[model samples]
Target chain A: MALLEARAELDVIVWPEDRACERSWLMENVVGATGVIVMFPEKVNTELLDKAGPSLKVVSTVSVGYEHIDLKAAAQHNLKVGYTPDVLTDAVADLSVMLALMAGRNGGIGVDLVQKGQWPNFSWSPFALCGPQLSTTAASQTRKIGFLGFGRIAQATLARLVPFGITHCLYSSNPSSPPNYARDAALAKQHNLRAVSKVDIDELARESDVLFVLAPGGSGTYHVVNEAVLKKMKRTSILVNASRGTLVDSDALAKALREGWIWGAGLDVVEGEPNVTIDHPLVKEPRCVILPHIGSATLETRGEMTTRAAQNVIAAILGEEMPSQVDLSTVL
Target chain B: MALLEARAELDVIVWPEDRACERSWLMENVVGATGVIVMFPEKVNTELLDKAGPSLKVVSTVSVGYEHIDLKAAAQHNLKVGYTPDVLTDAVADLSVMLALMAGRNGGIGVDLVQKGQWPNFSWSPFALCGPQLSTTAASQTRKIGFLGFGRIAQATLARLVPFGITHCLYSSNPSSPPNYARDAALAKQHNLRAVSKVDIDELARESDVLFVLAPGGSGTYHVVNEAVLKKMKRTSILVNASRGTLVDSDALAKALREGWIWGAGLDVVEGEPNVTIDHPLVKEPRCVILPHIGSATLETRGEMTTRAAQNVIAAILGEEMPSQVDLSTVL
Candidate 1:
């Protein structure tokens, strides 16, 4: 709200909705705004850009993922787009590991058993609630960790995995960057890892004891961990998606869990989330630990994200370099 | 089962009951056995040891903790006690970190929000269900991690915390051991810790952003983390108990969680567990994430523990050195 107060020098209009900003209100308001700040719900498309009438210089979003933003439209209008990124990396990575452990260790089902008042029905058994151990032990044979996209979030996650005695690391990045074995070996040494290397999707699926989905959302990465990839995964493996819901096909994951293709899944996001109700397939799966799309819901992370977004909008309006301007050339 | 089968020549009378071996049944069966392989439920006392007459040389338990074994009685009878130790360390450590993340990130409440269908009732607000993050972010203040007792499990848990950007470390061991500044300094440097030192219970309680209770269970440790210690904890701190239920006072913890003495608690073990039913005060607390006593429930860990117990029994029966024999000289 301070950002809105700061914009009183310029004729600035703020969306007055308690919920997500209304499409019609955004459309009408864009007619004369020099700067606009939004979140995940708003879509910056050509129609909105056209309505701005050349007055709009910047669109700042208070979120890390910008798949909802129409990059092509922003590029066409020569608009500087800014989104919060690194501020949220730690919070998201923390949640990602939480999901991995929850799924692998039967956290959701165990809690449900306690919450539903069914714990006293039986005595403690040796194998009750037992699942694959996440940490390496004296008895452990292999400890392999994998990632769908080896970016900042994935690397942060890998750093967490090092002290757990994770031996091998495998990941797949975007097709543009070729494998750099030397660089990866250096990274491995830095983290005291056995090995860290790029691998193809199939190898990543088959070898990973725990596979994390940390890719961006959009057509390029949508449903990347679908039926085929799910099938290739070890039966003891766990799938965690803290990146975006679109990266993992929920239906495929549900079926895989039910059929024992993988041991379990921990998901923070679902495709078309908020709309994903109690009746959703992933929600109903006993093994799937589903959160309500709160990967960066930490107070510190959210506060930083909002402050950065406001600053980016302020900078863009003042004809200064935006703090975190999205590179539209590669994205579009 | 294979371990039991391996002892073809010994007159090993295995407990045939699927449930916890009844006290009456155990008393009847120990009449002629030279050794007994028991679990947490069985009490090794004067009565059972008396029943076994002079034949009982050893009581091997398939658990890491021997709280159930009446140490005084065993020591009085000159009985050798063997327990499975190091094998289950990783399993417990894995669960400890899981509980820390779960409590700090509101994994329990988030899962319930989905299962209870309350997610659709409200819009995604900026701070909905957000608790203190487990990992130290770039914006994080001094991240202090504390341990009530610095044992193997606690040290293993600390290793997991290293990559989470933990800055300070504090721990309290048994009062008898003198603090070695030089050794502590070396350890601090080895783990890249900002500081690591043995502190008193009061300082440990007050300083830790995330406090872990990994002390042994006994009268000395019972209610060690009581209301006073809970009160000293930071309002944003989290308490994790992966060691013993008795180490934490359940009533005090439930009160702390309700009154917001600290942020939240992740408890894998609770006082009078298995009996910690649906209506238990700790279970009912929204901030308390409770799990049944399954800290060492991983299939691999459990198998190794059982094998070790059997091996201890075999070693004791043959008058050989036990694999993980308890130092009864000190216990007595």
Candidate 2:
């Protein structure tokens, strides 16, 4: 609606109303187009660019991830790309913490028992329905939080845990970059944490009471949480993935839950999500709490993302610099 | 198990194994018993005191709420009562925050959609499955957190929300007690909040983005969140009850959800819970996420509670000061 209202002198075309725009419809409509907006389901490659007939100036997506867009081809086609990033960091970070709480507290199992009409017959005992406590208790005075990626969202999550009496923090980032000890010390001081250090993936898995997977998704980062990492994690620890599906191996997670290798898992994105069925291995596991890829599904965040995408397109069409234009060279 | 281990020379009578000891069995075995340990299901009353025949010196309950116990009767009978309070505070506070997050987001609805194998058929749109975000977003800068009771647990919960960028706080405590402006100012300064003040139930409902019920359970607080108060709430607000079922009216909440008086609810305790079935109004409402009275259900917290109960009973039996002896006068 914002895009439609903002298009003053320009003619705007929409792929006939559906859940998503079909590729054939987009291909047939892209001829001589000045700007295009796409979602995760659409691919922007050489073929789509060729169909646009060298007249296309901008491609804007209302998402933080641009994996669906072929950045190398876009650079070759001399196109400007825009994506909504920082706007969604808080929304996704909030979901990440919520998933951690759900997974650690047997939320899915409890909901099932109530929905199945079994709660009436369920008996309460001192230890019934007990799970590992997420907050620091007198019995467990120290807590360690670990992150697979220590980017903006991950840091936001760590900041939230500070009030939960978390004692230490450990994270793993891109190994290609050197550890920033100065930055780590500064963050520890800012948060009043006992320690904040970077470590290898295995150490992170072993020491963390809750391990969060917030790394980007792609072949290079795929299956980072595999059988070996799952096995190395504490038996009482929880796993939370809110970033992307492919970062975690579904089979490995299923097997881990079956054998009690780890306590539980909470996932917002799954390996083949939106196609996940009741028969899915993780779905069958009572402790695995799954959401339908709604990490950034907050009305405020989505509105901002759509409005930003529209601004990017409008600015490019007016021959002004796009607000959030992506440097395709760096992406490639 | 802790009680058994600690009882050195005392004759410990065990009830024939069951989920809960029957009243008949307890009456039959409690004859001339010097000390009694009970859970939520067991009521320590005048008749039970008569059954014990002046030998009862202590009645220790492994819970924070002792509504089942007759405090006035215990005071008349010259009995020392013990209840675990501070030990479970962190655990309950953690769950309170979890409930708020789950309710503000569409956690229960999302889980149902996924579990029913409807995700594949469900189409993703920009605003689909969108709910009000729990955290402060750029679009919505200020957030107000409200509490039904601003006691220890409620204050702990408020501490956890500080990192979520919550700006203001409003809480309604006991009307009999005057507002403590000094304490509220100190708390506001400590949390870096814009303001912290007392408000009436209606104003709290209207202004809070999320309202948490953390008051004690009794006739005094019963139905405090009835239809009139629910009607005053924001359509985008959420209601979370981790305190007691009686604080909220189940039928009224169901109707509120059905009519969109509030966005959603996450309840750990429903009115007449454990008896809640699929036919129950709140259980049947997709927006109401119910958990079966597991606010203090953590292995660490429960273990601490049991141990504390044991210590209290043993201390009273040995004529020593019980660690958590309840003043029946104050309770009454």
Candidate 3:
């Protein structure tokens, strides 16, 4: 609204305030629209693009993931695409570390016990409600953190973990991208870590005290943390997924948690989220802490993302370069 | 058991293992006991000292807080008091930071919404489920952290917050203790914080984005964060109490939450904990994230504490300097 109000020269129409814009309404209203800003709920497919006609100069998404956008079709139609990235890295990374702490400390169980009025009956034993400590203690000297995708958010999470006395890091990035030993070495030195090395998915699963799934969501990365990988993880290890839910197999994770293959899981996103109910497999597990896809839901971050998305649309419409234009070639 | 088994010369009698030893059982078993190891539930008062006759040389508690013990009675009885401190610092500190993050990010509300199966109906908007971000963002350039007590756990908690881009710190230590400006300067420089200074309680409440109550629990500090202080706090701020329950007034805090005096609160310890029921005012608040007094509840920390308590008892019985002995003069 701020962006639209700032541009007095342009006329704007908003989807009549609802949780999400109706498809039929959007299709009809977008007929001769010059620019469109959408959230994750709106599917920016070829159909929507076709209805918008050639006048649509830009499609800006207020999210880092562009999976909902038909990038190839947009490119063919000569429409520039922009996504809100980099801005949400800190917010998402904060949630990632919070989830790690929550999962490792039996956060869900503790809260449930309290909320259910069971605490009075819950006697305090020496190790009652005890879970793995997030910070490294003298008894447990070494701590290793693993990242499924060592991207911007993962690296930010690593920086936060340094003070927790984490000694080592292992991450799996795009297998095709050549490993940067120089950058890894410098990061290790900078953070005073024993090692920060790239490794195979199996090694990452087996070795990490806490495994973080921060990879992109796509067919290539789907179900990367499946039953086999979960089986390889330590019984005391924790799994945290702040990335897209599809990157982890929900059923497999539930089984692993039930069988004590992994200690706990903290998920901000589930395979089918917003649709997740109390009867969901993961939700039934006592140790599993699940939040409803709120990884980048912070006032500060959301404000920035909205501004960025608006800026992209305004820029593209004015025949100027989009501030965060997506590379169509990579999407294709 | 390990300690008793290791020492063949000492005669040890074990309590009939229950959640907590019954007072009758403890009284009978303590008769002529040379040393005793107790948890928080077992009070080490003058009556217990009398029941033990003159044989009691030590009363070692496997806990950091010794408020359950009658310190003056122990001092007069010529009994050495030992407590498990420092060992659980990391665990408690970890929880302190976790609580802060949880409070700031609306963790409790989100979990409840999902657990209660309301998430499916909960539609996502640009600002839906948005709470204050724990990490400082470009728009919000500064974050100020406050500490009610600048003790070991508080310092450790501060260390964890350094990476979150907290710019300034305000701590109100024991007013009787002379201010250490030099140490504050060094700490500020070490963490690259803009400032680290001791301030009055009012200033601490007014300035802090998140105020941590880590002070000792006693008459002097009881209800330190009462209605007036709560009123002075920022509406966007958070209050986290990982210390003893007595330091915070539960009703006042609940009112604060109800009336939106502050954004939210994360409490590990309530005024009447272990007994905090569903009807409890704070528990009834949507934003209040209450844990079951599990601040130091970690396997590693508990194990270390148990070992340390045993060692203290063994050492005291042998007429050697007990490790981590409590200064009885301070108690008096």
Candidate 4:
């Protein structure tokens, strides 16, 4: 509600327009709205049947996830549903790379050294404060890149990692419509990547020098990278999680990083986030890089997302084809 | 001696194979040395004469400053004296730009916020933790870049800063030199910079939004940017010192930064380093960025310096031109 008020261009009355205001408040606020916008938070159930009045037209969301909105409600309303997607892929991927670089070189540890004034008196050796350089060396030979869910952002991230000397790629994903093997094969052909899917997660852990998690976060993918899978990872392997926090078991991860099961973890999300505390166990490790969920916060990308979201609502209300609409049947 | 023992190359031999044992242990260790590298502590007068003997051929110091070496000694011995000169200009200039950027935006302070886990819990506002960006907008647009001693490195630093929307540059040099107006003109022509040598140091302080102390350090240049100059500088202006620590009074600088005489200071050198403690007054300021004496420490640059020093010794022994000989006339 606050976001809409701030972005008043959105003028659409829906079941959720004045969810708590009053009986006709939705109609009052969006008197002639041609489009309706929503997110995972708003429940668009049967209650929408009574409130969606004739003025209601289209639906859009600020989120990529559309789990809460009722597609049935949207269909009954005969309204197009719009959602912002793909806009965040590059920005999120850039953050993942930043996290990986910071973690691998112990840059996160330098934070303490900078502020504490210990730099001058600190006894340093060529080997001291030295961490692995991302460039493939004679010893490491080749950096094998892998992804748990190779979606839009994951592919972009892989492209960026290539210049840093990646040798092979492996990935896994849930089977999509008519089977997505053809699509996966086409993409691999395009990027010259080896596209292997839905392999035993253990293979991903063992063969990968860097693993990126790009799958949607939910119950089905909960704790996908658990103790057994983590144990299978190479001791020098790095795990980069930018998608969501729930897919990883934080306690198990802390233990693994502590006991040297893997080289490091770079995370932009943590379960029950925005509440990440200093005492968070992962923060204690020299190899973990925890960003405050700024994956899609680049100036250009965020600005574009905002403008696109606004335009989607405006266009849908004007009774035009939505720029983008969620196809949730694929997910269900 | 310590450096020579660490590096035993087929460069130069300053003593007889039989007299190698009689030579000063320090000189003896730097055997097969092509260039007799000397820094501040190793006096290159008669002491070097007795030590270097006939094997002592080319004298190369690893620093831009070579006042400690004796020119007459080299001339008398028919020895070439080499010093590292222009190799680090770009690297040092790059660091100056980084320091300016970091100080202007208060990047170093964020290290504490992110590492201490104080983010996300409290939402930072539009103006919160915000310092002025390098490029100012229409409402408030004013920025002036200045230098204390505009030499080669200063010129390089100025070139790097031009992209940041700088409109003017004011610098001072040794009053004794017949005003380096030609170089200033060349810089102006190349960078389209409004380069000028101000007669009064206070004039530069009043006009500049950032002051770079690129002057040499010693009795001749000591306390050049003193309280008087700092007082005249804009309150929002910053000071960066990569040249020498003695150019600015450390205590006065600490006070200036603390009391807001100027925005901040970025220092890579201190008056008494290694001996300087965590409790040093300058280190107490959160705005100050004090790097160890690593201006020429980049792997690429250091390797070049070491290799060049070896070449100097090798060439001098072979009666070839020393690649970079120090103008000892300046030291006297």
Candidate 5:
């Protein structure tokens, strides 16, 4: 607010409510605007750009994911785009680990059982309500963690898993990328992990006691974790999707969970999320824990993202370089 | 099953079902029995000992907690008792961290809201569901983890927190126990923690960003985390109880949560548990995530505990030292 207040001549309009702005209101108000800031829900498409006409110099979003924003449209209009990326890495990574733990430990089931007043009827059995342990102990000598995509959030999550006696780290990323033995060796030594190496999807599924899907969302990566991929995962393994939901087939995962192909799942993003109902296949599964796209919902991270988005708009309007500008050429 | 099969020469009665053994049947069938192995629910008191008569040589429980066993009565009856320990440490410790993360990140509320079909009604606001991040991210540099007791489970939990960039560790144990600076310093150095020191209850309450109660259950520690301590804690702090439910006063905690004295709590055990209902004070709080007592409810841990318990029974019956004999003098 102070930054905007400094320029008294500038006019600003914000959505009146805490909710995402209505599409019609945004299109109407965006006209004659020099800059606009939005979030995941507000689509920056050709229609919005055309509505803004030539006055809109930039569109900055308070989110890391830009699949909602049509970069091809922005490119056609020769518009600069800014996104908050690394600022929310820690928050998303933390939520990733939280999901992993929740899935592995059956946290959702535990809470639900208690909430329904069924706890009093449950008996203390030797193996009842049991799930996989996330840490290495006397019974388990080694713990292995796998990532579908070895990106910033995945690595951050790996860093958090080191002290849990994680012995191996397996990741399946872009196979075309060259192997870097030196980097892998350094990471292994730093975390005292026995090995840190890239693996194929099959091996990643077979070995990971907990597999985290942290890949980007796109048609190319859609359903990367389908029935075939899930079948290879250890029956004791847990699957966590803290990234885009499209990377995993919800129907396949729900079937896998029901048939005991995989032990459980924790998902932040679902295929048709924000519209997921109580009867959703994944939500109906006893072992699957679902959250409504809250991977970056932390006070500190959200505030930082908002600040960064505002800064990007202010910079773009003044013809200054954005701190975290999205390269349209690559995105397009 | 194989282990017990080998000892078929000895008369043994097995519970026919996977569920808890019928109480009336146990009391009647235990007559003239040389040994008995039970779990948390069975009370090994004066009545049980009297019923077993002089034939009962040992009573073994498939749990680390012996609060249900009356050691004084067992001593009078000249019966050796065994309790499983160490086997479930890793499982409980893992759950402790899981609870802490769930409480800090609002996992329970997030899942519940999604399951209730409320997400579509909710808006995507910057700070709608924001809570504290468990890991030391760009927004948070130092994470302080506190423990009510510095015993095995607490230390195991501390080990897990190290990878999450925990900077400080504070614990409060029996005041009579002398501080072991050398051991604490070594732990600090090993985990790259800034400091690891024992503190008073007041300091623990005031300083911890996440407070875990891993102390043993009994009258001495009952309600240790009362209203005063809750008031001293930071509003953003999280409280986790993986030990015993009695450690926290449920009514006080309910009021604290309702009035926003602290952020939230994750409880695996509750006072008068197995009796917790939907209208229970703690369960009624949205911020409090309650689980039926399931700290050691892992397949590996529970199986190990049962095997250990059986071994104790077999050894005691064979005129050999028990594998995990409880020192009656100390316990009494």
Candidate 6:
């Protein structure tokens, strides 16, 4: 909505309805398009690339996660791929925090009570609906945040979390770029935190108060948060994932939530997600908050993403440097 | 729940199923009740006071608004009264901010699309679902904010809004107290905002980008936000109410929403609220976000309130001075 509203004057844009459907008119329109804007669900693979022809300059997508789009295909066609990333971290991270708060505070029951008109003018007694509170008070002693992946959006998301009483952060990444330890330490120190990189997922899961998954998608880290990792977490710990649908095992997470393996879970993504149902193991649970993949849905973020994507496509066609290009080697 | 858990040793507590129930019972172990806790709905008038039978020196209730309690009756019986106040301001203020954000960003539609499965992945189009963005940069100007009543909670809410890029603030109070122009100006200056009290309800309604209702409940201020106020606001303006359900005229607000008289309304409180339904006019409207009176529903806030209420009762009975005493004279 933000992108459309922001760039309404565009002469031409390429958008396909679904992955499998490619109408001749849609392909023809793309061939004549001076600019192109695609989304996460729509695959811009070789067929679409061939359809796009030579006029295509930019390929703007409204997603932080670019798993659906083929960067290799775009690179072959000398097409620029534009993706929306850093802009969405705040909105997504804020929602993540909201989810954690809701899960810990019995948000489902509260919303139900209101809908049922069971709210009393004043409640009596203790621990009636007491869940958890997040704060950086001395009483909390040690607090550390864990992220499954370290990237630009994850870093920005961590920055927001720091002001809200997090004392340290532990992250597990693929140890690329020689582990830039000094820069990482400086970043953590800037936020009065100790930034540590864990070699093992168990250490990261067990030691951290809250675990956030911002790791990349696919088999490399698929189901990284399996039963063992969940079991290793402190009883009062929380798990948050705003990255991708395949990172955590939904069944294991459901069991963990039902059996109190962990205190609560806040997932913006889940296994077999967005075909998400009320019957989905995590969906029906009160302790889990399920969003319909709105990580980059904020107006500011989406608009910026669309504009950048458009610019990338334009730069690629004009043979200029693409603003944001994914590593083709990582493609499936 | 916090209070009840805190005093787990004290088992017996009065609980009415609803507002009209008057059934009372005495448990076998009633001899050990060191304190009594009651709210306005329980009718702490003479009969219940006499029935309490002198063993109770302290009575505390969990609320900042204490219109239901009779202070004179408490004083006559030599019973100490305690109520929760300042502790809940932040929670209510946070809800106020949430309401404002939800309304401005078209959250109602967002929820509906996700619920109905109308939203497709990474969707973008010309004018799809654009709404106001809170962040401000050098190129973007801050939005204007106004308050219908400026109290401690309102001040706290204003502080939260500051980070969301609010440039100015205006408030309109009752016909009395003659508007503390200098004080309001000083407060606005403190926050680097252009705070003005010169505006009447009409001017505020017309000029404010966002208008907040932070007044008290009941007859004198009933439906203070009528059709007149709604008519004055900009076509893109939003209204937020977290104070009392009786402050806004639901029919007028509903009609305004239906007519798009204003952009949207975020209501934590509704007139004759909690009785709201999907069939309700406002609920049927596209731009209205009606929350079920969750102004101070956060677990942290509710727990602290319960604890404070208990502490208030304990202190007053022990003759150590009630920590939170209601200003009974303020009640209408």
Residue A323, candidate 1: alpha-carbon lDDT? 89
lDDT of 2 by residue, A196-304 (tens): 9999999999999999999889888999999999999999999999998999999999999999999999999998777899999988988899999889999999999
- TM-score-based ranking: 3, 5, 2, 1, 6, 4
* Predicted complexes: DockQ each: 0.63, 0.78, 0.79, 0.10, 0.72, 0.19
Q: Write the per-residue lDDT of candidate 4 for residues A266-331, one digit (tens) a residue.
A: 787776665777887876776787765556544344455555676677676666666777654543
The Cα error of candidate 1 at residue B173, in Å, is 2.2
TM-scores for all predictions: 0.95, 0.97, 0.98, 0.56, 0.97, 0.79
Residue B141 Cα positional deviation in candidate 2, in Å, after optimal superposition: 0.5
Model 6 chain B: ten consecutive residues of lowest lDDT:
B21-30
Candidate 2, residue A244: CA error in Å? 0.9
- Candidate 2 CAPRI category: medium
lDDT of 6 by residue, B83-173 (tens): 8887777667656665665576655555444434443442434235555554442334667788888887888777766644578888887
lDDT of 1 at B155: 86
lDDT of 2 at A86: 88
Q: Which 10 consecutive positions of candidate 1 chain B have the poorest summed lDDT?
A: B118-127
Q: In angstroms, give how far residue A49 of model 1 lies from its true place.
A: 4.1
In model 2, where do residues sit more than 4 Å from their true spots? A15-18, A330-332, B15-18, B330-332
Expressed as tens digits, the lDDT of each residue in B81-184 for candidate 2 is 99999999998999988888888778888888898899888777788889999888888899999999998899999999999999999999899899999999
Per-residue lDDT, model 2, residue A199, is 98
Question: Each prediction's interface RMSD?
Answer: 1.7, 1.3, 1.3, 8.9, 1.4, 5.3
Residues A240-328, model 6: lDDT tens digits: 88888798999999899899988787666767655765566776666775555655555555556667776666565556777776555
Q: Candidate 3 chain B: minimum summed lDDT over ten consecutive residues — where?
A: B12-21
Query: Positional deviation of A172 in candidate 1, in angstroms?
Result: 1.4
lDDT of 1: 0.87
lDDT (Cα atoms) of all candidates against the true structure: 0.87, 0.90, 0.91, 0.65, 0.89, 0.67
TM-score for chain B of each model, two decimals: 0.96, 0.96, 0.97, 0.83, 0.98, 0.84
Best by TM-score: 3
